[model samples]
Target: MVQAQDASEEAGTEASGGDEAAEDAQAMMTDESAIDDQAAREFFTSGSNLYSLGRYHDAALQFQQAYDLSERPALLYNIYLAHRDASEHAEAAVALRLYLEATPDADNHAALTVRLENLERGLAEQEASRVSAATAAEEAVRQEQAERERREAEERALAEDDKNIIPWIIAASGGAVMAVGVVTGIIALGLASSLDENCEPAVDGVRFCPSDPSLELENKQSALSTFAVMTDIFLIGGGVIAAVGLTWGLVRLGGAEDDEDAPTVSAMCGPTGCGASMRMGF
Candidate 1:
């Protein structure tokens, strides 16, 4: 700090003089130039040492610093050499182009041009390799997406089949029960009607049932009572089964398709026979 203050005082005294101050200023400028040259030399030596130690990128930076201090186009070519040794072909190409721009009339222009062409070719090959790798990655992603969609579609199809199976089974069971009930009921009615003339009402509508008290008549009446009770039981049971099946089917279908139409049921009863029917609107 003391030396810097003394130097400033000396510069102020020199400036106070006339020709002597101007001469001193010129000498200072000369000394600054020499210092810059010495600093540039130090940077250049450091860069050479680093390069010999196989630090090509560091060598390139050191050469760049030297070129900045000296403004020498030859140093730009040295930067290109360091970058080339580091396998940075694109950077080497850029440095060579800048060197050509800085020293347009250099004697080695043809040689630099050949080297630049080689570096540019290597850069182009690297770009093509990257593009090919990117395209392959994109194709792999597309195939993976397609496979995922296909699996999802298959799963959805299986789910739909599962949803429909319950309704199908219920409908088939209801149909079978209804058919069996109707056939058995008709046979029971026929057997009961066969005794209509023989069996008559006694007191308070109690049946005499075969019109006389003979053993054969009593047996016929018992058979008639049994068949009548069985007819009612089977028909009522079958009706309950069919109703349960239909209700369950409708409920399941409604859950499956909330936006779709529902099924309709119709029934008719007569003296000879009774039956029901169903229809789906959608």
Candidate 2:
């Protein structure tokens, strides 16, 4: 009988222990539920405050967090409202669609569907307008580049023409000098022939007898000597100048295009004589 009583007491103790464990588990669940509710309330309050401050995108994020914890269809509607006010049409449309799916029997289902369609259309137009603006900007850049290249080509051509003309000008100047020399030599020859016809030779070879007594033979002889000296001077100078000019011109024409310095030739005539000068630059 003592053993039987001891077993009954043991059974009572075990039953009491099981009851306490069940109560403890229930208390733990209640605490966790309270914590979740507090968190959800905080997120919801934050979302509402952000919305009032005109931070629609931030408000939408907070509302999404609250809905994640609570799984409330009403919170999804708040997210749609926030996204729509922020002009985030695509996000707003998605939120609205989710809300409608979650709450199929919502009172404004038809109106929300129509609003979603409008948002999608606006999104399409915005994308098309952006593509067109990009295309126009690219075309403007291409045209500007083409214009710049054309201007550069024209400038290069003008420079080349100027370079080519320099050689021709030098050569022409040399030809003109040679022609002047030839004319001067011809005048000297004419003066000599005239003297020969008007003066008679003497035995000493240094004296002359004038055919005309009043011809001023002394002055005529002095003029002839002057003309003879001038003719020799001009002919030698002119030939040297012409040769130099032609050679220089050929060199210039065949030289490298990048050479910046050019040689120059000049001619001068004075009462004493005529001569040519050349200058070169590094």
Please give each candidate's TM-score.
Answer: 0.60, 0.58
Stretches of candidate 2 above 4 Å error?
Answer: 1-34, 176-282
Clashing pairs in 1: none
| Tens-digit lDDT string for candidate 1 (1-282) | 000011111223344546886878777887787777777767777788888899999988988887788777778888888998998888888989998998889888888788878778888998999999999999999999999999999999899778667555756676676566677667756655655566764454246663454666666556655655555544654565566556656666666464144455565655444555665544
Q: Using TM-score as the measure, which candidate wins?
A: 1
Query: lDDT tens string, model 2, 121-200?
Result: 89899889999999999999999999999999999989888876776675676577667767867876776666677666
Which predicted model would earn the best lDDT?
2
- Candidate 1 TM-score to native: 0.60
Superposed Cα deviation of residue 61, candidate 2 (Å): 2.8
